[model samples]
Target: MQEWQNACQIAAESAWGVTTDATSVQSMAYDAVRDGTSLKSQHAILATHRVADTLRSITEKHDRGWDAPKPRFTSPTVVYDERSMSFLDDGTVSLATTEGRVSATLRLPDKKDGYQQQYLDDEAWEHTQSTLHERDGAFFLHIGFKKPAEPSRQPEYGTVLGVDLGIDNIAVTSTAQFFSGSELEHRRRQFRRKRRRLKETGTRSALRTLIGIENKERRIAREILHRVSNGIVAEAERYCCDIIAFEALDGIRNRLPAGDVFHSWAFRRLIEYTTYKARSAGIRVTRVSPEYTSQRCAECGHVEEANRSSRDEFVCQSCNARSNADYNAAKNIGERAVRCVQQSTQRTSVSRYALKSGTVTPDEGFTPRDGGVRG
Candidate 1:
């Protein structure tokens, strides 16, 4: 793996040197340097492919008027295609190396219903490319698979559940469930203080500790996101919702305060995690325009800046409706989602809005049906 990494780096540097600009990147002959490496022919070809991909990415950024720098591969990782790697019948992985082919046992979790077993037992999922990398003095292999996506459900007859992401709270649902961000913020502050102290020390040990701290922080954040996303999906399922709606995050960072810049990535990641999880549960996820969602009154359709009394409080000036700020925003999001779908489908006879209790309509305010309120 080390030899392959070095060879790939050298080949990529050579490819970078030969290619003058973005226009010539596609037509450039990357295969000319294949014979110059000690790696096997197939591995050498894959290295060139990696180099071409990197060059293409860099060139694409440059084309977009961004000052992107050339990429350098400092980490040791080996990319493998179908021809260079195989899963043997004996439950071992055979990989091509500089010293010829080598085989290793592929370790997996013991759980019978684990993701690895789920994919392995299903013949429909086809294995594709993979990457082998080292971390924490241990080697790990990341395998990719592909399967046909299920058909998406129509939004016309769907029950929508709106989700509002905010700095004060990690997430708020139209159903009145809240995932507070206070604990997360406290942990972040603790990590920040520790990092600052370590930086001030300025020693080799401190540098190593910093790296460990960063990794730990990332793990904690990932775990928290996974939990939050799981809760979001569970809430949708609890309400028998078919569609989960979120505000479009086109310029969320610009809208957020300068100190809350870091939370922008968390917001995006939460949406991504929820989308996949909801899809797995036969639910559809969609995004609606975020314009005036916070300022608009969910109860009376009134739009005014003063509707939001504070960060956590919402008081409608027109209708005197009172509710949590995040909950009101989530309700507006759900209403907008329903309106958008109804307009797109041209269903003028009846328009339905999803609420915590049940579906609501213009004619009936809130009627009880099947242990839930319907309008």
Candidate 2:
């Protein structure tokens, strides 16, 4: 497996060095490296997929008028397709390697309700591709499966839940729920301090400790994100929300306050996690422009920088309405999503915004009314 990974990495580097086009990179890379490695034809071809993916990413950035550096594969994983891999009835997987074919026992999860079990039990899902991953001297196989998606609910009749992401508060919902980032930030600071001390020590043992610390920090962040995402989905479900909305993350760094540390990837991951979870609950996720969401008043629709008195407090200058800044922004995001869906070409009828009190049409504005359907 290690030999296969190393060969794939070299082939990917060669492919990336030769061509920038994703369509032809696979064949060109295969032709160049097929004679060099003992890997089977299909396995060599699969290795070029990594190079093609990187080139496609670079091309997308270029199309968006952004500069992106060439990707360098530090630790490449070997990809296996049907031709190079097979699952036997004896609970073993036959995989093509640089040293030739090898069979390994498949370690099925013990949990009956686990994702692997659920997919394996479902006849509708068909196995697609799988990747071999190496971590801490252990090898694991990640299998992929695909099935038809359920029909989406029409936005015209959907209830929208807005979510605001920030540095201080990891996430804030229009429903008045907040996930604080204080603990995460404190843990990150501690990790940074420990890493600094380890670097100062400049010992082999210290370097190993630093690596372990980094891994632990990643695990902590991932766990927190999962919990926060789950909570966000649960909030939407509690309100019977059909759509979950968020501010678009493009140019988010510029929108944030100066000198504030932002983890763009974390925010993106949160959105991705929420999307998959929401889909399972028959909810759709959408994004709206971030422009003035923080400044705009959820009550009077007033837009002013003075409305936000601090990182945590939002006092509307026009109506003197006081609330958490993140909550206010979330409301604005939800309102924008409602407007967007209402104005969409697919929406021929009036669309309503979901609030804690009830649902209101765009004509009624965001004002709270008495005695209506509960959100």
Model 1 local distance difference test score: 0.74
**What's the lDDT for residue 182 in model 1?**
82
Against the hidden reference, what TM-scores do the models get? 0.57, 0.56
lDDT of 2 by residue, 30-103 (tens): 76657666767777666676566666556445433467776656574777876788777787889887677899
lDDT of each: 0.74, 0.75
Candidate 2, poorest ten consecutive residues by summed lDDT: 148-157
Q: Which stretches of candidate 1 lie over 4 Å from their true place?
A: 1-156, 345-351, 362-369, 372-375
The TM-score, computed over Cα atoms with residue i paired to residue i, of candidate 1 is 0.57
The sequence of per-residue lDDT tens digits that candidate 1 reaches over residues 1-375 is: 666666556666666746533224323433444545567777766676676667755644553345777677778798888888988778798988877888999888778656886776688886767899999888798887766442222334456788888877888998888998886777789999999999999999999999988777765776687788889999887776777889998745656888775588788878887876786676778888999999999888899999999888999999999999999999888888777766675332124545666665533454333665322
Instruction: State how far residue 220 of model 2 sits from its true place (Å).
Output: 0.7
